[model samples]
Target chain A: MDLRQIWILYRHEVRSALRDRSIVVMSIVIPLVMYPLLLWGTFAAMNFVEGQAERLTSRIAVQDAPPAHRDWIDSLSGMGGVSVSEWMDDEASARESVARGRMDAFVRFESPPAEGAGLEQNFQLRVLYSAARDRSERARSQVEEALVLYRGAWIEGAREDLGISDPEWSGFAVVQEDLATPEEATRFLLALMVPMLTLIMVALASFYPAIDATAGERERATWETLMTVSASRGSIAAAKYLHVATFGAMGGLLNVGALVLSLRWILAPVAGPEGVGGGGLPLSTIPIIAVGTVLLGLFVAAGMLVFAIFARNFKEGQAAITPFYMVTILPAIFLQSPDIELTNRLALVPVINLVLLLRSAIGGSLALGPGLLTLASMAVTVVLAVTFAQWVMRREDVLLGSAGAGLWEFLRSHFLRRKGKA
Target chain B: MNREPVRTQALTKVFYDESRGQVRAADEVTLSCSEGEILGLLGANGAGKTTTLRMLSTVLRPSSGKAWIMGHEVRDAPEEVRANLGFYSASTALYPKITPRETLRFFATVNRYPADRVAGRVDHLIERFGLGDYADTRVEKLSSGMKQKVSIARTVAHDPPVLIFDEPTVALDVLNAIELREIIADLRGEGKAILFSTHIMSEAEKLCDRIAVIHGGRILATGTLDELRETTGLHYLEDIFVRFAGARNAGSAERENAG
Candidate 1:
């Protein structure tokens, strides 16, 4: 294939794409401005909802409690956002009230855990609430905390009466410490949002360009003219693929940059300064993330071109590419779950593997073996997609959108024919 | 004698349809156009005019038979064939976002015109096509006629020895059509072999040194206008086409009824 011809085609496509307003908006404007706005809007909404939830009062009902316990529960009335009411009914009735929203939650003492069971056995208090109802769930936790505080006060009084001063009577004290640095902590939070968002943005960035270069040319009737040029079909396809991949890579870089800036400047301050480190993503992991992102862009760009070329027009191309876009994005959604990791098996999958690799790289946990395997697998898939695109370009029926006979029709005419049939 | 600039030997292309079985879009069509001559392909809609031009342009491969452009086999040396031929159709379009100057430059470069000569060739095409006024304007903002001019200029930017025009004046206005006819005549004078397809009898009568009437993917008649008139004893080219196409249609109907 002639490199000069390919370069000519590539330069023309890129120049044309750059002049398009929508392409400019999607690849550059959206990453730089829309992302920060979206981040700011989401954080503002979350804060507002949390404040509203805190101000709402929760009603709790007490059932099957002794007089002494009832008095103790009554003291919770003075606490903020908690309303205590006595229920003179069976446990079933109290539970019905909580379920019906007449009460947020109900606390029941189970006969002091049976008197003869043992002194070692603690009192059994059951808090009934529906997790589906936010207020009921909140009330259950609040009541549990109140009960624990009351129990502690009672224990201290009993100890004073027995002249016991040692704190060991309660239990051994447990101390917890987090060994992660500020950067490591930020990486986890950033990994949850950045890699997935970046993958999706890169796919979006390549979508319009890929479709415009392939199906859009056909729609405008320029594809035939280009095909009649001296350039080989493979060279033309390679040039288009390269043009699309550049957009994807640009999108990835812009998104990563915007995300880091937003997190460090905008979101971190809202998250009270400890949200993300001053410097986002360790310096050591940048190379891995960058390489992984570029490879993913190449893979996505080639895949989009193959799908887009199957369409006969711009609208049909959009329809054809939407499913692929969804397929690429749906797997990246799984990246949101922190539990998913870059295992060997996951590293073999396409979009998911890239997201996982990015996640690992950001978190500084990327193993060389799995990382290299992911990159190699992505490269092989990209090569296959590009080859398929070139082959499609060479097929007249495909490029012309001519309706070719289906396999079933071919079978009916040949293999399925009866003996002596003309 | 002199090497034919474009030649096809039983160049056949068959398309298979589920309901119609094998449809012969172009069937055993043997034809040639020598340098300094214009050969007109006359056919009705779906009469394989576009298909034949497509095959010769190296845009489509023939199922059976062979086509050559300046001695380069289309199947074996498609790039070489494309390099030596300039193919244009009503469907040929320009990149909307780029100026005509850029479009010409791009085509010239891809056609492998010498890097040093590309600018000169592009400037010449702009002046030749009278595109200088709006040559730097994006194609999308240009008029339909201007776009057509740009398309034609780009096609001939490499100055190939053979030219193929498939209904090149289909959507053009009368004045632009006349201008295009003049251009084709001038190219023929320049010794480029030209194969043009059109249904307009006047176009063929005025420009073609020889005309081929194709019906149902087969060339039914091939001769100059006077030769065809004498052979059919018809006074006009339209009457001659009517007779051949009518007979072909009747023969196909008879075969279908018999089957």
Candidate 2:
């Protein structure tokens, strides 16, 4: 309970952690540089693939179009990346050619154009393209667009010939109006990614330091040195908890910050200019997200420290704590579907609640009941994890690696034991 | 009477090994070291030397009985005991990244040393231990000899009245071992009661004011070297140790047969 002793021990860990190259690199440098590199590499690869797909020509065979539509049919050949060839074989053979990649598409009008009742040709057009082939699908779409344009032009000519006004044919038009604010537009984009990112980055950040604090001390033969100091085991645990949690929170924030800062550039191609039209989150939700981040840091850092205490060395510590990384991530992954909302029951689930809470906050409609439950849920988990870690730290055999018990035995002894027993 | 700086009464520790059930690592060890005294626990490996010292330092909890550091019971007041004691063993190592000066200052602050005296105490230890040349260097960057000196300085950083050294020279070279003995002797000269453990007979004979012979988790005999020599009629401390260890093992076998 001595603040002075805890502070001294905390400073001890901080000094060691700052100089420990692995901790610095994992928690600071990687988070700072990783997002930008990932965004750049992704966009570059996407552009290359799209450019390659665009430059390939679409070859289509046109068949049985009357002289009235011949001009428009021939225009397909004039369009860029489109080649039109007349079909001389049976329709079956032409369809086969499209499927086998000999032709990208087969454009066939019904065998005969029906004479319309009043100066209009009534014919059904069938465009055959292989869905499995990208070129075939593109060719069909190109031909379809050209045919529509040709029909519109013909209608214009026919109207002129009949002396008809434009209002006679055009009757209705549909216009779309979006009333979303800039904050809402950017907020929806956060719900899907931020939850998983926060958990994963915090978990990763907590890894090396927790191991260094517990198993690293044992390996370096300094655990006994620390044990003999005047600080209580609980104080030592608290100091270590503060140290690891700081790194975890810093890492998650840095990565999220870098990504949010570059949100416009990263989303421009996919979401268009309006993707990040205004760069601001709702002021009310910032505190919620901040609390969530802090809670996540505490829970994950305490859990990592608990698991790491079971190990006698760094390698064993990593093996011991690796399962925690997956368990931390699996809940986020389970809540991947945004429709997974925080019902009263789901609100108490650990990582899922955080995901839902953050998602609801980003979407600008976080209900008070769910938000409080989420905070309480995470707070309880943090307390339990930290308490268990502190308890383990006080055990002579666990701290000294003298006991033969592993993870299962530790848990069994803790959870399954009778009242008032060790 | 002089105050006992380190005292234990019937202290014991039992560990359950998978192959060997219910092993008593330290059994009914009753011993005490007074002010300005050097007491040695001499035994072979796994003869309860480290275990007894570990109990006194509050590293290992005693399964039965009690140990006190400067009259503070280790079980009830662990931090209190640690505040009055300094422990240095092979396992009590210096932080690789911390300089010796920082190590001393940090330990002093943690052990509740006076805030104003910390800087002076740290400087004194630095010069006293001849760590001036490498005092600012990280422990990992220092030579083994230099690191050894820093470790020794770190042990008494808080200027505790009671010190326990559990086989600290087990890994040191012969020359370094001799140097460490001299350092320990100097600490005793400053009136610190030290409980030193070793398996080496010469280390006990030359350095310890009183030596306790331990075997099979129990202390077979405890007295000054001259008193032990007289009682056992043995010239060398090594033969006396063998005789004591053999007697304990033979007594155990005979008791088992009778049972």
Candidate 3:
């Protein structure tokens, strides 16, 4: 309860943690550069794979076509990345060849032949290809593209033959337009990704600091020294919990900053420069993101400390903390489903609610009532996590890791013993 | 309020070790140290030296009996007991990243030293522990000897009237061990009640104003070196320790046989 003593211990923990390489790397360096570097790596990998696919030659064969289509078949032989060949076999044989991978695709002409070799003629064509093979699929698409060009030219000739001066109307014309601004388009996707990324990054950032503050102290033989100080156990717990939580929250916000800055580039591969706009989140939602991130840090950080303190050594502490980190962030991942919205019932759920709150806030559709409800649930969860951490600090088994006991047995003894006493 | 700076009445601690079943690490340990006196708890390893001192420092709660530090009962007012006591053992360590000056200032502030006087107290501890040369360097970068010096300085940063040294020289070289002995003697000279524990007979012979021989979690005998010699008709402190510890072990064997 002594604020001054807590402040003293808190400052010391911060100063020491800043000097730790593992903590600094996770809390600062990773947040600042992890998103951009990972996105860049992914972007480069995609380009490499696309280039390889582009270089692959797709083989196609023309079989049993009438003499009039010989010119089109000959032109296909000269097309880029298409090695077209003449097939002397029957239509069924050509199809079998395509299926057996002897060729990428086959083309055949059905009977009920054209009435004449003129613009008014009607023809039946079927393209054969495997859906599983990349080359077959590509050949099919290339054949379709070539057919489209040929049909356009045929349409003009048909108009001339029919004595129709206007070539614009191909029966009916359809025009499409999008009403979304570049920023709005960017925000739509950002709303889905930012919340999940925030949860994961913040959870990861606290991983090392939590272990260093708790089990690392015991391993280095410093916990006894710190415990000998005049501060009450509650004060020490408060200071340690806040110190680690601040690091986690700070890492998350920095990651958001880095992510926003990298947004234009991350989306550039899909949406050209102008398509994604400046890639900034809706400015109005910053306050909501900030408050939600802080509450999340509080809850997640204490969860990490509780797990870490239960372990006997640095290695065991890491093993204990990894699962808790995954568990906290895993719930937020479910929010990736666009079907999940900030409904009245969903807003009462803990981390899922925060994700919904952030998603709604970013999408510019957040209702005040749901937003407040989400924040309240997160606050209540934070209070519980912190109170549990403080109470655990008073336990001798927790303070001095349960000697030689399995993690479950350690926990069972403490909780059961305390309950029985009460 | 207790007049003695350090006092205890039949202190005991029982640990539940799976292999050993129930072990009494410290059994009804009664002892006291007055101001300007160094009371050496002379015993071998696992003879309840550390456990007894740990109880007095309020780091471990006793299963039974009571202890006081500067007039504050350990169980009722642990924070006050910690504020008035300085505990230094081989296991107590400093933060490797902070400078010695910062370590001292932090300890002083947290131990409830007045805000304005913290700086002066830290400066005094630095000089007292001879930490002037590498005081600014990170403790990890300092040599082992220098790190030990910082550890000693941190123990007395709060200027507590009661100080406990529990096998502090166990990990130190001979030169650093001598330096620490001199420091303990100097603290006693300044009227601080000191409880020094060690298995080394020469250490107790050279420093302790009075010696308490302990064995099997109990203090077998307590007296000045001359007083003990007078009772046992022995000149050497090692022989005297054996006389007490040996007799206690033999008595346990006899009781076991009787059972």
Report the lDDT tens digits of candidate 3 across residue range A1-422. 89999999999999999999889999989988988898788878999989987799988877677786675676666678888776787778877888888889887766545564453345666889998887789999988877777678777776788788674555576667888888777788888988998988889888888999988898888998998999888898999999989999998899888887776667565667666666677667888898888888888898999888876678988998988887888878766887778988888888888888999999888998988988887898889888878887777656666533434666666677559768
Candidate 3: regions farther than 4 A off: A42-67, A70-141, A151-180, A264-274, A403-407, A415-422, B1-3, B18-21, B253-259
Give, for candidate 1 chain B, the lowest lDDT window spanning 10 residues: B1-10
lDDT at position A264, candidate 2 = 57
**Regions of model 2 farther than 4 Å from truth:** A46-175, A264-273, A403-405, A413-422
Candidate number of the best DockQ: 2
Error of 2 at B164 (Å): 1.6
**Please, what are the lDDT tens digits per residue for candidate 2 over residues A237-307?**
89999999999988888877777666656656565656665553555777777788888888888888878
By TM-score, is 1 or 3 better?
Answer: 3
Candidate 2 docks with a DockQ of 0.80
A best-first ranking of the candidates according to their DockQ comes to 2, 3, 1
True contacts kept of 2: 0.92
Give candidate 2's error at residue A188 in angstroms.
0.9
For each candidate in turn, the TM-score is 0.81, 0.86, 0.86
Question: What fraction of the correct interface contacts does each predicted structure contain?
Answer: 0.82, 0.92, 0.79
Q: lDDT of model 3 at residue B225?
A: 100
| Ranking 1 against 3 by lDDT, winner | 3
